[model samples]
Target: MPAVSIDINMFWQIINFFILVFIFNKYFKAPLMKLMDTRKEKIAAEFSEAQKNNEDAALKNKEAQKILKDAKDEATKIVQLAEKKADERKEIIISEATVQRDKMLKSAELEIQKMKHAAKKELEVEMNQLAVTLAEKIIKENLNSDLEAALADKFIDEVGGVK
Candidate 1:
């Protein structure tokens, strides 16, 4: 066989490489790269928005718990105030009842005293009339002077002894 001859050139190799790079960039590389970058940006924005929404929800929950605790404390205070007022009213009612009972007892005692005074006056009048009638009968029957004096002294003694 004859000796082989080799002919290699760096300029042609460089030209072929540039042509291949241009063809690939125009056909497929630019659009695929743009789509991937846009997708990555949208995912990052969504994650950031989700984190902000979670923070807002946590703050709202804390506010709600504080409001609920305040309402419960207010309700308890109102109930305690109402109980105190009820107790005060009960005390007032009891005091009024006691005053009324005392007044009634006092009036009843006064009425009893008045009745006793009227009965005593009636008894005094009746006893005086009976003594006068007995003295008149003794005088009409003509008793001796000594006996009459004795009977009058006895009647006087008996009347003086009465309450």
Candidate 2:
């Protein structure tokens, strides 16, 4: 509004400012922005990889738990089977022992019966010999074969048919 003064230095200053802007845009701005974008992509990719690894770990942990549970079930079945086999074996052993005991008792009873029969036979023979001796003494003479046979038969009949 007063006297307008044009300075030549102002023109030079404007030209210098434009040259510095052009140099920075061509040499620094594009490369710095590209580097920032690459860094951001690398960080995003790392985050995705970390998330995938976490999911895989969780799945593996679940699989491990399932395997452990199956092993426990199998062990329980094995133990139950073993107990059943043991019970069967115990029953078989007891039955065998009982059969053996019964057989031994029967054998002992048979042996006792045989011994009793032998003892009774010996006593009868002794009694018959004593009777023969007494008859010979009472008659004051030895008996002939026919008379001795008759006498023994009569004595046996008198003694209630003892054999």
Best model per lDDT: 2
In model 2, the Cα lDDT at residue 135 comes to 62
TM-score of 1: 0.64
Deviating ranges (above 4 Å) for candidate 1 = 1-25, 133-163
Query: TM-scores for all candidates?
Result: 0.64, 0.66
Deviation from native of the Cα of residue 76 in model 1, angstroms: 0.6
Query: Model 2 over residues 6-96: C-alpha lDDT tens digits?
Result: 5899789989999999999999999999999999999999999999999999999999999999999999999999999999999999999
| Model 1 residue 80 CA deviation in Å | 0.7
Candidate 1 collision pairs: none
The 10 consecutive residues of candidate 1 with the worst lDDT sum are: 1-10
Estimate candidate 1's RMSD in Å.
Answer: 7.5
> lDDT (0-100) at residue 53 of candidate 1?
92
Task: In model 2, state the lDDT of residue 38.
Answer: 99
Model 1: residue 139 alpha-carbon error in angstroms: 4.7
lDDT for model 1: 0.85
